[model samples]
Target: MWQQKTIHLAEKPRGFHLITEEVLAQLPEIKNIKIGLVHLLLQHTSAGLTLNENADPTVREDFLQYINRLAPEDLNYLKHTYEGDDDMPAHLKSSLLGVELMLPITQGQLNLGVWQGIYLGEYRNFGGVRQLIVTIQS
Candidate 1:
C-alpha cells in the first residue's frame, strides 16, 4: 500500500524543534500500516529536517549552536544576501543538515528510538509555515 500527503507545519522561530508528535497527529493513517516506511521531504531551501535526541532539550540547543558556528551569518562574502543576512547561511545550514528523512513504521506507529524524535531545523527567524511531502509505503 502507498499513501502520500502534503502536511503544512506550523510557523516557528529559528531553532531545532521537536516535531514527532506534530507529524504523527497529521497522519493518523499510519495506524493502518503493519510494517512500512515513511519518507518526509521538506519543501524549502532555507530550512531542513533531521532526527535526533527527543528526551533532552539541550541537545536541540546544542544543535543550533553547532550549526550556527559551522555557518555563521557574520561573513561579509555572501552573495545571496538579497533575502537577508541569514539567507545564505540558512541555505548552508539546510544543506548541511538536509531536508528529508526516511524512517521505519511498525505496528501502525513510527518506529523511532526511545530517545529519537523528528526535528525541524528552522534556520530562518520568520520562515513562516513549512511544507512537508510525506510518503508512506507498506
Candidate 2:
C-alpha cells in the first residue's frame, strides 16, 4: 500500500517545534499499515526537519540558541541579505539540519522512541505556512 499527502503548517517563530502529533493527525492512513515507512519532506529551503527530544521545551529552546550561534545573522560576509537578516542564516540552518525524514512504521504506529518526535526547524522569523509532503509505503 502507498499513500501520500501534503500538510500545511501554520507560521511559527524561529525555533525548534515538536510537530509529531501534527503530522500524524493529518495522516490517519498510518493506522492501516502494519509495517511500512513514512517519508516526510519539508518543501522549503529556509526551513528543515529533524527528530529530537519531545518532552522538554527547553531542548527546543537550546536548539534555537545553539543553531543561532552557529549561523548568526550578523555575519557581514553574507551577500543574500535582501530578504532580511534571518534569511541567509535560515538557509544555512536548513542545509545543516536537512529537509526530510524517513521513519519506520510498526503495527500501525510510528516506531519512534519514547523521547523522540518529529521537529520542524523553523529557521526564518516569518517563514509563513510550511508545506510537508508525507509519503507512506507498506
Candidate 3:
C-alpha cells in the first residue's frame, strides 16, 4: 500500500507562496501506482484554491488585486451576518470564486501549467491554518 501525508497551508494568503516540491513528493514505490486525480479542498469559508502564475511576484499581486476588484470587500450585502464586515464579504468572495479544485497528476506530480502555481486563497485579514486534502490514486 502507498500512502502520503497532508500538507497544511498555514497563513492568511494575499498572494502565491511557492511550496517546496519535497512536501508533496511520495516515497519510494516498489510497484507502479498512477495518480489519476488530485483533490484540493480549502477548509475555511473565506479561502479557496486556484492554480495561477508561479514565476512572477507582480503577476500574483495583480491577480490578487483583480480578484478583490471583482468581489470587492466593502460591498453592501447583508445576507450572512458576521463579526466584521469582511467576514460576509469573504464568504461572498468565496462563493463568487470557489472552494475546491481538481488537478490532474502526471509524472508523479501535479500537471500545472508553466506559469501556474497552486494557491490557497485566503480572504481573511489575519493568518490562520488551512488544511488541504490531497488524494492520489491509480
Candidate 4:
C-alpha cells in the first residue's frame, strides 16, 4: 500500500523544534500500516529536517549555536541579500542540514529510538507555515 499527504506545520521562530507529535497527529492513517516506511520531504529552501535529541531543550539550542557559527548572518560574501541579511544564511543552514527524512514504521507507529524524534530546523526568522510531503509505503 502506498499513500501520500501534505502537512502544514505552524510557523516557528528561527530555531530547532521537536515536531514528531505534530506530524503524527496529522497522519492518523499511519496506524493502518503494520510494517512500512515513512518518507518525508520538506518543500522549502530556507528550512530543514533532522532527527536528534528530543529530551533536552539545550540540544536544540546547541544546534542553533553551531549552525549559526557555521553560517554566520554577517558574512560579507553573500550575494543573495534581496530578502534580508538572514535569508542567505538561512539557505546555507538549510543546505548544511537537509530537507528530507525517511524512517521505519512498525506496528502502526514510528519506530524511533527512545531518545530520537523529528526536528524542524526553522532557519528563517519568519519562515511562515512549513510544508512536509509525507509518503508512506506498506
Q: Report every candidate's CA lDDT.
A: 0.96, 0.93, 0.62, 0.95
Clash totals in order: 0, 0, 0, 0
User: Who is ahead in lDDT, 3 or 4?
Assistant: 4
Identify the runs in model 4 with alpha carbons over 4 angstroms from their true place: none
Q: For candidate 3, lDDT tens digit of each residue in 1-138?
A: 324446676565554455425225432331244555666666678767666777877876776787778767667766565556567767766776677777766665666788777666677776377776655555
Model 2, CA-based lDDT: 0.93
Best by lDDT: 1
Residue 48 of model 3, lDDT score = 70
Model 1: per-residue lDDT, tens digit, 19-127? Answer: 9999999999999899999999999999999999999999999999999999999999889988899999999999999999999999999999899999999999789
- Report the lDDT tens digits of candidate 2 across residue range 19-60: 998888898998988999999999999999999999999999
Model 1 spans > 4 angstroms off: none
lDDT of 3: 0.62
Predicted structure 3, TM vs. truth: 0.76
| Alpha carbon deviation, residue 98, candidate 4 (Å) | 0.4
The TM-score measured for candidate 4 stands at 0.99
Query: What are the root-mean-square deviations of the candidates from the true structure over C-alphas?
Result: 0.5, 0.7, 3.4, 0.5
Q: Deviation in angstroms for 117 in model 3?
A: 1.0
**For model 2, what is the alpha-carbon lDDT of residue 5?**
88
